[model samples]
Target: MMAGQEKGDLSLVALTKSFATFTAVHPLDLTIPQGSFFALLGPSGCGKTTTLRMIAGLEEPSGGRIHIGDTDITETRAYQRNVNTVFQSYALFPHMSVMDNVMFGLRRRGDKNAKAKAGEILELVQLGQVADKKPTQLSGGMQQRVALARALVNRPDVLLLDEPLGALDLKLRRQMQMELKRIQQEVGLTFIHVTHDQEEAMTMADSIAVMNAGRIEQLGDPATLYEQPRSTFVANFLGQSNLVRAQVNPGGTDRIVTVRVHDTDLEVSREHLPYGVDDVWLGVRPEKLRLGEAGGPNQLRGIVRDVSFSGVATQYAVEMPWGQELIVVQQNDGSARAVLGETVSVSWAAHHGFALDASQDAAAGAELVEDHG
Candidate 1:
């Protein structure tokens, strides 16, 4: 256990970091509630890691304050702050046993019952049976648990996970995602995770901040950010979105706004899109689209350009007349399917469609995704 059992919300006020001429993290204001799983998600060079490092005291902010509840710790050294980071490398001592590795910090501080304290945390991480094992003797997943055990033993006010699962395989990364969430809930400690993987953040975080060019593009619960993206970058970055240039039509009833995409007219919820703008980007997620008849509230005709199967889902690339390829994903549940080189009609409900400012680049985050891969 840690020396101080203090607990409070972590707050960042106008947090900014710059490297001479380059500003890595623009003025950022964020608050992570106590005991919440929050993720800072973005592609490479987006400043998520810089913000995390500043909070961990590994990097000094050029401006602003960091607080745990009401206590300011902006000038605190890395070791002095009640914060711990679980890095991708694990960083376990190879010569020591698992118990010693976990208890090293406590023993160095002269905690008399360090062994028992470490044992309890090891068991909490389901590593009690392997306490005597060396770091070299453990599997990758087991080694990760030992690293987690070492962090949890200290019971820091906030746990920073800097792409801790980046070194694990896809299957094991997913397994650890759940395990990390389970551990956070069981221990009731605030967790700040920084990663470029959208799916990883969605699966593990209670809320996410999508960063782009050192600024937050969007911040909300995973479902809200995915279903009701407010910007072109967010609409494309969170997941695949089919965006088409559109002009807002004059006729709209109460809550619906009409927009004309090419020759087709579609309606979007006013809550999701603004009405005064003449030009907008109509957006819809791939999974929400259905291959159906031409007549519908929001429908478009396109030719199937490509098809791919990945066990649980089938993805189709539908090419529009204006040289844009829109993606559609369908579940493999015995439903009728579309084939390549076939003309098809795609339709979705009015609520499923969203609108983004036409001024923003439609392909804002596409290249970044490819670059990361």
Candidate 2:
């Protein structure tokens, strides 16, 4: 854990898990500050669930340490850890009412006021009106709320949520996202949520740890992860991007460098770029690329291939001579889109793109090609 890590903070150091000859998760080192809404995001079998299970003590790590607050709970039993998990399945009893389900854990702990606490939590989750209803009588969203109230009834120091909103419809999922964030803020409990939904992670988490192939590719706040990704995987995974080939050239100071993209060569401030070599891959977000009104240092001429209206924004597929197709998205304000087959000038500012290494570019490019194809 870092020096500033506070009490009730969660820490995992050199955490590893394996099954026979296959390694499910590599050694992970992460320190989550107390009262933070943190997310472990990745695809299925990418080790995200395994990491969460380790933290919850549901699956013992093959090796490493797990700590909550100032105490080390590496070898602690699952019930001994001050953590509660809200799984995808509500796991509520079919015969029991909502209040009883919420009070189940507290009853096991022999709390004399468990019934009162359960009633209070049901109201907190806005399920007070359905306190006497069974799990089968409740809607999908209502069932999920009951699960959340059940997990939180004990007032655990940390809460683990594994795709808690997976079964809800799109509209309900959006509503629950806000509700979950609000509840976390109100309780001030550390939350470690696991999900594959990028938008959900972006909307609710204070900080996200994006995992790929059993390792954390990048971990930071949403703005930093989206604006200045350190690797190609990070850049391409979060959202749409235009990864153009480029060559780096020496500039005035060792910290600065010039990048050549296609037919344009422009100076760039390389303060955040760690790679000091000449060969690089530049990544630009779709919104950063402006159309029409030419004459810029980094400019490219391309023919518009396709355009689609999406209510809030318009998407365009532009083609270049190199057989590369770039995607650009512009907000809709009742303005007409550029006609297909029209030659338009595309340009962006220096701060809009980040240089990437060859290996990172290769990974990003392969994924882009696969996604577009």
Candidate 3:
């Protein structure tokens, strides 16, 4: 059996990267506690990968210090650091057996128990039976486990996963997400995952840092970020949100604020309102709204312009009297469903609405459609 590995907390202070005239990563400070699964999530060109590379010592920082616990590894070479990286490509040595490939690193490090250590890691990754197989003999998921085993065999203080599941199909990708989480928990190693997939990050990471324009826009647990996004980019990027312009009524009570949207007056929690703003963009998630009679605290009248049905839920686009269309999603329960061309009133609780500064771009999260296209 192999010796237990020491887990180290990772910290970045003023880390920055630049490419001539453009800055890829702005100077930023972040701390990842030991044994936590932290994710750096963002769209392409947002510097998530660049940040991971810097942590792995593959990319020299333009300015910043990287620390693993008390040790400063900012100037250390990639091979000299106590860290390992698993990339999108498995990068396994095809000529060597899986067991041999895993032992190569340990043997190179002068460990006499390389074979035994490799065997233990193989079993840890659930690939013990495939230890004799070649890289080509394994499925995509198995090959990935082998790659992980090779890295973990070295007993690094931290593991960096850079879109490691990008090559797998949807079903396999999801399965790997769960497997990776299990592996991380079993090893208790600090895991820094870089990905653009929001669902994947939310599913596996204990905490996530949402990056945009080479800087972090928001950082929190998945539920906090989803239910109460601080910025328009985060609100729209993490998931769908219905943002409508509204004017906050002055002289409001401390616990609640009255916001006027179109012809409707919505009572929103003061805690959810943007700091020091009279005019704001009210935000609500589609699923949080109920399309029915106007008996709730906040209600709006609209004409059902379109309706689309998926197996699990039905989505409706309702056009308000002021000409703005709002989208609503309802579960496919046995309850009656709204039809197109019908006049309907949608209502929701007072606290369901979130407010942001009116000056912020209403189209902050609009890039998702173009990104997928």
Candidate 4:
């Protein structure tokens, strides 16, 4: 850690970055707890990478202050701030053995026990047996671990990971996610990770900030952001959501507001719709909808347009009367499944939904869903 910068949260105040007419990052403010795993998540060109670069002091902020704990390091150079970054490329020296590559940084600073310090970090990342091998002799995952070991050996106050797992295969990427979380907890260092993969972010980070169009759309724990998305962008990005157009009905004015979707009426929790609005989007997750027409508070009738089976679960694209398709996901647990062209009734509890302002585009983040999933 930088002198006296220990145990203080990383704070960014009024941070901004711009290029000609395009603003990469708007004026922003955020605080990250010390010894925590925080993720900046969004699709490409969403300013997540730019924000990470700014935090690393690689790209100077247009207007803002960066601080570590109580110490202000806004004007400090990257190396002087006690911060290290590990990139996706795993930039290791191919000519040098793993041990020597890790020890190079320590030895450069004239540390007396560079070899011992390097060995300990190598073991922490579970790459001790391969210490004598060159980078070319190792697998992609092992090379990534070598890069992590090299940075951790520096013992920096904060580590910035710029899509560190982007180069790995799908199976290896999942494995590295677990390994990264384990290493973070054991080292007890503040880790700031940037990635466009939603699953990767949710699997590793304790807290996540979802960015869009150079601004933070939402920030919270994984479950909170996935369960109760505040806007259409968050709803579609985190996971699949079945959002329908509805109007707040004046007939049943109770503690919970009732909204009319076509001819059916549904209730949204008062907490969801803090302010009264004439029109709203009733949002519910695909998994929450059941394929039963039985007695339920909320029910909608639709024709099954498409059916997809992915072993774990079956997904049905049900087209409603208004030509809107709502997806319903059902687990394969020996229950009767709906088929294509079959008329079915979908039901869900009223409290399972959330209401958003109708003014927002219903398909705001639709095009980017595939990249996230």
Please write out the lDDT profile of model 2 over residues 241-287, one tens digit for every residue: 78877787655565456677676675555765655567777777888
Where does model 4 exceed 4 Å of error?
1-5, 251-255, 294-296
Q: Candidate 3, which segments miss by more than 4 Å at Cα?
A: 1-7, 369-373
lDDT of 1 at 373: 29
TM-score of 3: 0.94
lDDT by residue (323-354, candidate 4, tens digit) is 99999999898889988999999998777888
Clashes per candidate, residues 3 or more apart or on different chains: 0, 0, 0, 0
What would the TM-scores of all predictions be? 0.95, 0.92, 0.94, 0.95
lDDT values of the candidates? 0.88, 0.82, 0.88, 0.87
Per-residue lDDT of 153 in model 2:
87
Candidate 4 lDDT: 0.87
What local lDDT does model 4 show for residue 113?
95
Compared with the true structure, the alpha-carbon lDDT of candidate 2 equals 0.82
Model 3 residue 57 CA deviation (Å) reads: 0.3
- Minimum summed lDDT over a 10-residue window in model 1 is located at 1-10
Candidate no. 2 TM-score: 0.92
Report the C-alpha lDDT of model 1 over 123-204, residue by residue, as the tens digit.
8889999999899999999999998889888878999998888888889998999999999999999999999988899999
